[model samples]
Target: MALQLIALSPIVLISSYLPFASPSNFSYPAIFNFGDSNSDTGGLVAGIAFPLGPPNGQTFFLKPSGRFCDGRLTIDFLMDVTGMPFLNPYLDSVGAPNFQTGCNFATGGSTILPAKANSTSPFSFGIQVAQFIQFKTRVHEILAQDKKIQQFLPFEEYFGQGLYMFDIGQNDLDLAFYSKSDDQVLALIPTILAEFEIGMKELYYQGARNFWIHNTGPLGCLPRIIATFGMDQSKLDEIGCVSSHNNAAKLFNSQLHARCVSFQGQFPGANLTYVDIFSIKSNLISNYSQLGFKQSLAACCGYSGLPLNFDNRINCGETKNLNGSFVTAEACNNTAEYVNWDGNHNTEAANLYVSSQILTGKYSESPLLGDSHLLAISEI
Candidate 1:
């Protein structure tokens, strides 16, 4: 059976148990995000050899911002809702003028675990945390040299009050699945969570108090997964997703949720909220019609004529076929009607929906962002 089902009722039901945190007067001065392609703004494009071009960011930016999707990612929308400027990638050639606001340390193919033996890049979560540490030191140095910028150099004020968002672990799980048995993959969960715990503790030591942690989504439902692993009807669940893979994702989320609960108990005065992206993605699939999504199991952009309209060899923007023929990948006229943007990511519209759900604070473990004690700090 798939891992225990998450509450999929209306938003009201899911949020009924959450303690009310009023949003009447709340604001976040900065947001520091860490993750992989799911939340990468431009780090991957700037640092890696990944191919990200047109048609990827056509829906919103009208040009590529190095995000894997056509428009804004969930992190981008979160910033918009919080009134923060879109985060600049830490690796961007043109450095952001203001580190006071925050910077993104996420790279596209980043994993929580160190890069595998065969992996091409070594930008793991550990490295991102190291970068954050370097950034903190740089801020202190600048503050010491110039009194004019000292206001922005308040490490405790900014780091303690800022919101830290994490959207990693998907790539780690994906690698595990392809290389190890189901039981082996399950065994890796504890190690992954340990890395997360260590990372969080380091941040806490550095004055980061508030955190928004997103669990992995339904991996089996991705277009690429459906094409690769859902070929057999018996293996596919009622939702046209591979049951085994989805079950694995559920297991990971379950363990992660429990860890978050433990973290709350272990760390005094820390606000670590777990975001249930698994349930949100599942709900979207189960309620696609109500959500105005016409295609829930296929990609909005990919090579045409392939199973589930996804071709592993081609990306979203490539217009030439593998045989050197001129053939463009099919893209939906209205991306808003599709849940997936490419084979592995969500469309801008779907991201908008997901971000709205997260903002509702119902999906979080404690007081929603609006009611978060971190936001209560009047300094911002």
Candidate 2:
């Protein structure tokens, strides 16, 4: 009956999907989310939640999850692991009772800066951050109305009792390169990082401390990107990895890691740690089985034929028995065998595995953190 359960019931009912969520491991009081679709939870699809995605999440939702994948996303797994309630999108009607365990200020395609023109797009990273600031402001203003900040003793320190997760920046690359030049994009990375710093400081200034920063995933491997532009899987770098897009992704990861490390150093009392999702994603691609994933590169549902493109691509959920309008290209009997659920995102099963790795040692294919790793808080 709680909101998190209400949100998760459909996801678990259909597939008995194991999200790998560790609700028992939450070390922080609140969980703040910001990012694109990967960690969106429910920002991008709020407007079009009915039409475009029903076909996408048909298996579970009996409708659309509005998520880019076939099942629960990485954030769902994180909340489950931490023992926190499912995080509601901050912008939801606020009709859902008790909407404050943590709010997702993340819109699907929104950016970091306060740009007026991007509202039409998915919640931009900048836009999402701004929304959080607004939410916090609203909370404070209302508290003032009731004289609660001073009168309410226990709730006084609510701001400091939270954790934040930000996984963004890939969309900037997509939008910039599509419209601007590569050089222009490269130049903007510094500016992007700077804005990111501002957002971090904004959260810190407001009392947020526990933070998990995720790096961008490989852009080159996505089906939508690769369909038109092909990459030769043969070339290997010093690490014996492929060339082209994923290579660029590798480069981005390096820079992202360095930037986060610098941030951790700059922010005082902020327990910020880099998630290295880039590295984890890369490894999933390199060896699917190594990560308990089946297929890393290809989409499980879509046109698996000689002709490949966006129009030809399709997601899992709907059964298109229509004559020629629908054609199944490639599909694994069990999605658990594949990493990618759609063209660009991972399947629910895939997300579970990744979330396990992120939680340190609660669950994972490999050990990445120490047993001494403690939750930032003791109370759920």
Candidate 3:
């Protein structure tokens, strides 16, 4: 399959000094994001008052910035290319955030299907889409009543011009593994993708024309999964990852890719691009030493222990009493040297590398090298 690049329709800009100006020929007036922690800017923290305390954002933001990772995610890197401000969470009302460019409905621990009773996040994929609808409706409502606040809200046309991005489904697969057998989990992929299709259809009907969809990465390689399932030697793969989990992820991605291909035909006016995040991340894990990462599977911000260093009870940036001693899951001395950040997320360095690969268009089904619009974005 040819790598399908993100091709946006060119819109003439009157001013070159606009804050949302894109250096590239293509200009996405805004970006509407949806998914889990992989792309969540801050929805989880603001929505439920989740305590994502210190050391989470110490490397980049130098404070708790609502991200599960230590720094910016791959979505953040992609947003920088458009020269727009980092998207504010839809649930966040603090600081009177300006949503002129975009809003993020993603939350940490979100799933495509409605969450279970004990789930940490209540804003499931369906809820996130509902929030987006409310946001769009309110934007128009407020605009109709008053014109003074127009500067802070997205233009009516931005809905069609902006990029709608998704990076979810990892948690859905993870949740299935905890209860269902391998065969049962594989059987659930079709149902999960069906829900995803419904959400896409909703967005398409709502005037969202451009879409950038990312396939889930190798969940088997996550430090959290390996620490929990590693004792069972029979379940391990050649590279020390849980074979069953990886297989499930592959199956999910395969079905998702097919769905995206079909969506192109279903939504005639939409540009749906499916990015292969699995290959990029799997390669990084398999060749970490060659890629300048010291720890491939171990977490940088996790409980202090050899190998994986992940404790389910003691999350990253958390302190607890263990074995008559107080142990805090502090971050490692060097972050860039580790691929995994806190067992479940990737490090800032890893995210940067992944975004670079995305821009190269090599990970996509189509070529990205010679596209003038793609080459203009800063490589960093």
Q: Return the TM-score for each candidate structure.
A: 0.87, 0.76, 0.91
- Measured by lDDT, the strongest candidate is 3
lDDT of 3 by residue, 226-302 (tens): 98887798989988899999999999999998898788777668777788899999988897776767888999999
Q: Which parts of model 3 have CA positions greater than 4 angstroms off?
A: 1-22, 366-380
All candidates in order of lDDT, best leading: 3, 1, 2
> What TM-score should be assigned to candidate 2?
0.76
The candidates, ranked best first by TM-score, are 3, 1, 2
How close is each model in CA RMSD to the real structure? 6.3, 6.8, 6.2
* Top of the candidates by TM-score: 3
- The digit string of per-residue lDDT tens for model 2 on 232-273 reads 445433333334545555566667666766766676576766
Where is model 1 more than 4 Å wrong at Cα?
Answer: 1-25, 95-97, 148-156, 367-380
| Candidate 2 lDDT score at position 25 | 49
lDDT of 1 by residue, 13-87 (tens): 223312232334345677888999889988877886577888889877898878989888888866664555688
Better by lDDT, candidate 3 or 2: 3
CA error at residue 293 for candidate 3, angstroms: 1.0
